[model samples]
Target: MTGAAQIAISGLDPRDRAAIEQLIQRHAWLIDHGKADRIGELFAEDAVLYGIGPDKIGRAAIAEWGRQRAALTERRSRHLQSNILIEPLSPETARGWVALTLYRHDGPGEGLAMPLLIAEYADHYRKAPDGAWLFAERRLSVLFGAA
Candidate 1:
């Protein structure tokens, strides 16, 4: 197990934990609501995302990627993150682990009942000069999903 995996939210100060938790929960809310333009605000200017799709670097690229994702109208999806563990490496840096579930809605008549993907994420974060925690790097590993 990595150092991040060894820490839990409960180990941190309540205020710090809450701040970190808000940063994470906001991601789900923003994506589900198609607020792509604002999504990039969650990450640092030079952040990187590595996952099943093409990796993205920098906030502009990440925001553009979100815009493209928002343009997908054929289906609606919901992303939920759970079991978030934040390990503060310093006052300005931290690592996190979270379990993610993605649910899909096929059409207007289709209920939002099917889970399309499940994954685990390991992430690094940094406190920006403005004093907000932002993702520096996010690495996602799928546990199960449709081909």
Candidate 2:
């Protein structure tokens, strides 16, 4: 198996791994569907997001950023995530990486398109008191295309 796949197979309980995966997927869905007002649900109260314009510290800041971006009605985006690998740090904490391929355009019509951003998210997750997994930190590293 590939290194990431192998590591994913071993660490974290199956249920926890699945939950984390859902959390990651939900983040992508929310962004793509313009559900910015719900963005706070995916993160810890004090989470930080780095390398997307400026660092957004705290859930409130992140939600505000999402709201502003969503207000731009002309822009459309699809965030595709893959190659997720989660490494357990403890029962309630873990770290992972997700490969992101973003296709975006403004004032859309069916036309030639290409990925606007190819990036990786280096993520840290924490399980909340209510037993939900949430992002504690998410750092984006762009490998190709626009930031």
Candidate 3:
């Protein structure tokens, strides 16, 4: 973790667990629902977002890429993230890892649907000056996909 990140979550008592949980949940909803703008809001001005198919940089680019991805698939996909671990590396820095499964009906056959294994994500988060947990960097390795 970094100094800024540490300060952001420094006072996170037990009661703040729910808030953190919601933050994570909200992140999923934003992406799964194809709410690009909403998802972009989660990132800081200079935030970096990678993975989720292909490569993207900056919050604005991420939003456009997300929108395009949703459009190209021509099918709605639900992304599930589990077993997320958040570790504080410093007062204002932290890292998170999570397992994700992406499923949709855009297979060869109309009725065909399968899970895309994103495997795991190694994310570095930094607390922005405005006190928001934004992805400083997110590295994703795809385990399996139809690509």
TM-score head-to-head 2 vs 3, winner: 2
For candidate 2, write residues 109-143 as lDDT tens digits.
Answer: 85446889899999999999999999999999999
> Please, what is the whole-model Cα lDDT of each candidate in the order they appear?
0.81, 0.89, 0.66
Clashes per candidate, residues 3 or more apart or on different chains: 0, 0, 10
Write down the TM-score for model 3: 0.72
Candidate 1, residue 141: Cα displacement in angstroms equals 1.0
For residues 1-147, could you state the per-residue lDDT of candidate 1 as single tens digits? 445444443356667768788988887787788776677889899999889389999988888888887776665778888889888876678789999999978667667476888998899988889888888998899999966
Which candidate number maximizes TM-score?
A: 2
Ranking by lDDT: 2, 1, 3
The true-versus-predicted C-alpha distance at residue 82 of model 3, in Å, is 1.1
Which residues of candidate 2, in runs, are more than 4 Å off? 1-10
Clash tally for model 1: 0
Minimal lDDT window, size 10, model 1: 1-10
Error of 1 at 19 (Å): 1.2
